[model samples]
Target: MTLRRLPDLTWEDVGALDLDRTVAILPVGATEAHGPHLPLDTDVTIAAAMAEAGGRRLSAHGLEAVLLDALQYTPAAFAASFPGTISIGGATLAALLTDLAASVQRAGIPTLAIANAHFDPTHLRALHTAVSAINAGGVLRAVFPDVTRRPWGGRLTAEFRSGACHAGQYEGSIVLARSPERVRGEVMRELDDNPVSLSAAIAEGAQDFVAAGGPQAYFGSPAAATAEEGHATIETLGDILSEAVIDALGTETWPRTKEQT
Candidate 1:
């Protein structure tokens, strides 16, 4: 009865849940280098945590949250130089997402909510393409809050707004909050705040992190990241996901009688 992850559940386990109130929560991120101090699955970890928190929020509203397997392979052209970074072509990523969306539709899930932590330009484009393709099929639709935009973006940390948060304090802090043991504190202490905006560099035709003035594959102040901030950021991210999904589903108030699990 405590099951939240779809991949961990049997067919009958899912069937026992109220089908009408179930929502699929897909955590999307890239398998790429975060920095010397952070882990390669940093983005994936953040996405999964955010989605899980959103799932809990949904549960509080009397809905069943079905957590989908996190998609870790995403388009990471910019971080290609890192040893641990693995990236797929944008088209390949797009097709994969499109197929998944279609499968969700065929399975009778009217809506799929994606909680993405990686916001690579190519990845965003691919997601947009997949959403378009799925909507065109008229079966189901994929909704991504795209926290990079407006109001939601503003709600995040200032480092995120700077757009050079690759493995910096913003990211490192989140990892610290989730799993402090994984962080290499020595390396993190050695790294300082990289003020260069990788976003701006990319706009100026820099295709990779080195060209973006992040030669070490990191930006922003890793030394400044704290677990407190990391937890706060996760909470903010969860709010973004919850609001986006709720708005997309057209839920005006609490969907049903509150159900605690």
Candidate 2:
């Protein structure tokens, strides 16, 4: 019933785990620009929070959740112009994901769940490719709850759904909740609203953050962010990840209950 950090455990501890009931949760993020208010590793912080919360939920449901070391370097071309943004090739990310999955499979873990917070187009495409490749190999099941689409996206806040939420309220709130010390509160409060939807701009052929209408590497309303809202959003993210993993396992061991929701 305890959630474990895989990196913190000894080889003996890992080897003794009931692998059949264990799910390794990988926190995937990007070292990219999130505006002047937030840190470059903003996505890394959010992904870690999601993974920890999801791992706790899985543990509550009688599953063994193992948290893996975060994958922080990812494709982040949109933020490439920013000073500290580290963008990698999408193919490199895909190959790394595949290799990680295969490594986990070899270590007796049957399921690998990704808790990803970065949503750059190239990064997302790489994730989809990696997930597909991992599943096709049949070595182990890889579950990715793509938060940008469908049911998952709908469950998030209005700012996030608006797609103008790079370093804005949506992401800023999470950073505030997880690492308040990193937020440049004075600058965040003075920033004007940039309601332009990055998604819509991308659809119109915009490539980077500037072309996407985020000259400051941000969009939406940053001043609107709150720690409470960030906590709520993190909880929702946890729900999305836990539900996806449970569904992927497809077992009747954990029955759904009204109270659980």
RMSD of each: 2.5, 1.4
Native-to-model Cα distance after best TM-score fit, residue 73 in candidate 2, in Å: 0.6
Error of 1 at 121 (Å): 1.1
Clashing pairs in 2: none
Q: lDDT (0-100) at residue 109 of candidate 1? A: 70
**What are the per-residue Cα lDDT tens digits for candidate 2 across 38-85?**
999999999999999999999888888999999999999999998999
lDDT per residue as tens, model 1, 1-261 = 232898888978877777666788899998898878888899999999899888887776766788999999999998998898999988998899888887776666777889999978999888888878877887685778888777788998989899878899888999999999999999899887799988788778998898888888898999898999999999888878877877777765455533421
Summing lDDT over every window of 10 consecutive residues in candidate 1, give the lowest-scoring window: 252-261
TM-score of each: 0.94, 0.97
In angstroms, the error of model 2 at 170 is 0.7
Q: Any idea how many clashes model 2 has?
A: 0
Model 1: C-alpha RMSD to truth? 2.5
lDDT of each: 0.84, 0.93
